[model samples]
Target: MTNSPKPRARGADKRRRLMAAAAQVLHRQGVERTTIADIAQAADVPVGNVYYYFKTKDELVQAALAEHAGGLAEFTGELDKLPDPLDRLKAMVGAWVGQRETAARYGCPTGSLAVELDKRDDGGLDLEVGKVIRLLLDWVERQFRELGLPDPDDLAITFVGAYQGMSLLANALRDPEIMTREGNRLTRWLDDLPSAREDGG
Candidate 1:
């Protein structure tokens, strides 16, 4: 007599499914353009059932934001297993380059969402949207700091900005090579940066 999965476990799985589908749909279609019914369809959950997990579209959007944040944390944790700061940072850029086609099509999962949310007349949602970008920026800043950079924060902002800026152009131009080219340039730049200790900072 095997025990069946608990109701709580089933509920959690359904909630996670909703959030994952919401993230993909939101990334492909800006927040304003996406609806709870669309997410319900994508998740394969009944439209009425969606409200049991997410009462409003905004709630679902928040869940998607949390999903992105969790994914970023997990990805950075994997990179942290690499010993050298430079290696980790370069690997980060490599991953981005690997996703050039997707970025060219979707304009970056985090960056596109951030841009769209930031422009919203509803001020509340925009405030929460920065969490995704801040996570990446803070992670990059930590890597730079570990490399003994004198201005890790500034370097982190510039590094992340370069990726976001190029992602925009790549999507607008429908050119994946834009990301490949800029990612390579950023990789080379990362390799060439001098450590603060070397400069006696």
Candidate 2:
């Protein structure tokens, strides 16, 4: 019985490694261009081992989606710990701007992935890729609502749109500084908000 547990534990470890590999490969090569072989090589597992865990590439994609979702939740969870709603919102913005270098290279993992998946028209998989953006939108909306904004949803949409646009520009220009500048501009705009002033009081 103890020996049986060893195999299960190893299987779980392998699966975790495979999931991490999938996310890395997907980000570097994109979903359409990435092959199971790439993922296996990244994970340092034999190519045949990929089939042992995942029956199809779509299944592996789902695994990667789960990883992204977990990352989104963890990010928001850290922000949720902050007492001030505006501070939480700023922190969220800062995170993207802080990773301006990475965005320049990879172009916002969730946004780029969504665009690629949507271009393929892979049935409902686009929705899966969209969940990350939706999570961000929902979090931003919640922060605005906590600040008692009348149009919290609209504010959320505006902020997310600007962030994504800045990311696109940063990636296209190969300049992280552009993203940082845009983030600072967003901070100034947030500060000048009438609702924010009222909420601060």
lDDT of 1 by residue, 76-105 (tens): 999999999899999999998898998999
Task: Work out candidate 2's RMSD over C-alphas.
Answer: 2.4
Backbone clashes for every candidate come to 0, 0
Q: Which model scores highest in TM-score? A: 1
Alpha carbon deviation, residue 123, candidate 2 (Å) = 1.0
Tell me the tens digit of each residue's lDDT in model 2 across 117-177. 8877457778887887898899899988888877899999999999999999998899899
For model 1, name the residue pairs that clash. none
